[model samples]
Target chain A: MKAFEFLDEIGTVNTHTMVLDKGLGYAYVEDALKITGEYFDLLKYGWGTSILYDTEIIKAKNELYHSYDIKTYTGGTLFELANKQNKLGEYFEELDNLGFDAVEVSDGSTVIDPDIRENAIKQAKENGFYTLSEIGKKNPEKDHAYTTEQRIELINKDISNGSDMVIIEGRESGKNIGIYDEKGNVKTDEMTQIHENTPNEKVLWEAPQKNQQVELILKLGNNVNLGNINSNEIISLETLRRGLRGDTLGKIQK
Target chain B: MKAFEFLDEIGTVNTHTMVLDKGLGYAYVEDALKITGEYFDLLKYGWGTSILYDTEIIKAKNELYHSYDIKTYTGGTLFELANKQNKLGEYFEELDNLGFDAVEVSDGSTVIDPDIRENAIKQAKENGFYTLSEIGKKNPEKDHAYTTEQRIELINKDISNGSDMVIIEGRESGKNIGIYDEKGNVKTDEMTQIHENTPNEKVLWEAPQKNQQVELILKLGNNVNLGNINSNEIISLETLRRGLRGDTLGKIQK
Candidate 1:
């Protein structure tokens, strides 16, 4: 049982939290999960970092995350790399062998033909994986070129192509990307535009910063799907969601 | 043995690294220590977070750190709180019982009489604790009020009062405090003034950002003592010290 149960703030229900696991050791994940296990919905091996560690470790980490009922996936970079190498089939096979239940299909670092991107999402879904398609360029200049209308179209397109969820690219820094301004403050107009157009429940916003998390949660209700969270901030984010933290305290409506 | 031994980069030697632990669990520490334990010299329970967790957990963490030959201590805020409550003696006794081998003496959040500050350091040393004193206010405006000369005087004074090391406060943000500018850039003029005036070896710089770490490593050589390192960045910081990362690669001199 959690402390301060008398306060009776509604804890995480119908909200999805995806944490980024960037090369954390086995015992570390085990301990962190013991405290914040129920809070996480997804575990991402961030941005090609999975390739740096032994295959055994990745498989073990996948099993650990699975124990908490958290779906595991490699970052979009790995998928993009596989696509570039003409190894999409091999990539899916490798993911299956490694115990990943989800796949992120993105063209953040490299260009993918629109049809190919759609097919990847379809293929992932057909292969019994939860397909999450991302919409944004890794380069800030490239990312800024896409108008809100274009982003909305892509998000809709990806969902239509059988993506279980469409992720907005916030990157690790969460600065000057997608709907965030240079200082990481949410551009409310752009965020609202995207939210209004997209299926809000199917759209997961990659909010890495604390301020961004608070803003997104406050603006879109507690059930906002948030991703790319730092592993250490799992419990902190759960507190924010439950309105147990000062930022959202007494502000979250039941 | 560490990977990439053929590269033959000189690893950390005669340098101190102090990592912040803000309520991490036992197994987490054990796993992190197994990989990057040798890099750490001091483990600080950041701010007043220690009081928030169970005393048993704190004792276990302290023992775990000690096993890795890393000295553990509560943050200066706790010391400041003790000073405020006139429980300095009790604080020392509690630290002993908690198995902390070190203590940080600071007036960051509260005012301390210079005589009392000196006595606190002496008391900690007398109680067989490695005494660390921090300089700079927690408030940015108040911290900015101190001139370079005043900082030098305080640093020298703390050492004279038997401080094992004096930490130049950058806080966790590493911005607009001590020698860091608003953009978290190093104010080289102020940094040089303090370094030239004081015994550089006795001063540990709190640099929490990657840029700050790179700048400090390049400017002061790899042996410049750094504190307030996030637990996840331990391996990354060690790589910077060894000229393994792109930022400091081919830039660090023998």
Candidate 2:
């Protein structure tokens, strides 16, 4: 039961918010998780941050995330970096040693051939990790060049290649990339087309902004998988989904 | 000298930023302070959040803040809540007991007559706390009614009423209040007028957004006092002030 249980009477609200832990210490994560762990499902050590932190801290953080049934993964950028350096085997070993249950395979910052991107997804699966493959380039122009049809093609290919989830890249900014416009507003037509082509549960949208989250929730229902969520917004996003926030108050049926 | 000396060829820079703590535990504060304590001066537990946490936690947090030479204070809304309940005396005593060395007095949410607001400022001064009074209303329309000149008048009056600092209310949103417009852009004309009218150091602008911080730093110089900064942005903001960010890079210099 929530603090505003009366408002969300139908009571079916499970917000799958994946928080970005950008270089936070284990004790800090523990203290923070005490207040907000129940609101999230996945803990992503953003970008190459896990590679930057001590191995012990990363392992400890993974254990903490798993304690709350939160799947832990290194950011796609790290996997992409490792793949670029031909260290994918080493990366898999390091990730497994660090106790990460999942890994994000992305070519957001680097170019991996479509064939290679798909093969990497299968390789990650063979390595015994739940894989989330991301589509779209980090650079806005390159990302926008992909037609909605092309995006659907990549999404289908990744899923076929055994990706557990496909992330529509929002790249922390959620602007001028994929479905989001320059002002960070969602292009509704693109969103609908993508949703029609992809399974909603297997697709996570990186929505770092509140308006995007509100719009996505109202469009796709509360269980919409959201990623790149700042640590501060975990509770607020949950409230927004549960109709406790003023923005989504009367709109979401409990 | 700061920890990352390679980034600071000009030795180190001075910055006075007031970060919003909201409701952080002692351990979180200790860890965060260790990371960015050299960057900021004061910590504000934003808007009645201390009421949600225990007094011992608040006291310990205050001690941690003080150890880092960061003065700590309860948000103006908390003080207003006590004042509304006519327990202002007890509120001051409680703040002192909790080791708060500063107090913020504002009428952003509630209506307080000029005399009462001024008296609160004077009382905070008499109680030996560094005072930070605020201008502008929390509601957009109400805040808009205060003309630039009127805001300048209030700022001057607050300083005269014994405030150590007078903050232009941005309500953690930094939009459509005081010198900021609805899009969170600074109204330069009004900002210039306010600067012309008030004694500079007595005014601290609440700039919660990075763009706002960059704009203020560019226009007002690196030493310009800023408030209501989110805890996560402390290092990022410090970098911006020193021209390390692309936005403020090569724009401001000693």
Worst 10 residues of 1 chain B by lDDT: B48-57
- What TM-score goes with each of the models? 0.62, 0.63
Per-residue CA lDDT of candidate 1, range B91-194, in tens? Answer: 88888877889999998877789999999999999999999999999778889999999999999999998999999999878988999999999998998888
- DockQ of model 2, rounded to 2 decimals: 0.08
- Give the lowest summed-lDDT range of ten residues in model 2 chain A: A1-10
lDDT of 1 by residue, A1-254 (tens): 33212223454568789999888999778887765677889888899998898888889989999999999999999999999999999999999998999999999999999989989998999999998989999999999999999999999999988999899999999999999999999999999999999999899999999889999999999889999999878766776676544356556787
Residue B90 of model 2: what lDDT? Answer: 77
Worst 10 residues of 1 chain A by lDDT: A1-10
Per-residue lDDT for A107-155 in model 2, tens only? 9999898888888889899999988989899998888789999999889
Clash pairs, candidate 2, are A10-A254, A11-A254
Error of 2 at B162 (Å): 9.4
| Tens-digit lDDT track of model 2 for B1-254 | 44576654443466567998754556777777888887888888766455544455567778888998999897776676567667788778778877999999988777898998988889899999998988877767878888888888889988888899888888777877788888999999988888778888778889999888888888888888899999889989887887887998888776
Best by lDDT: 1
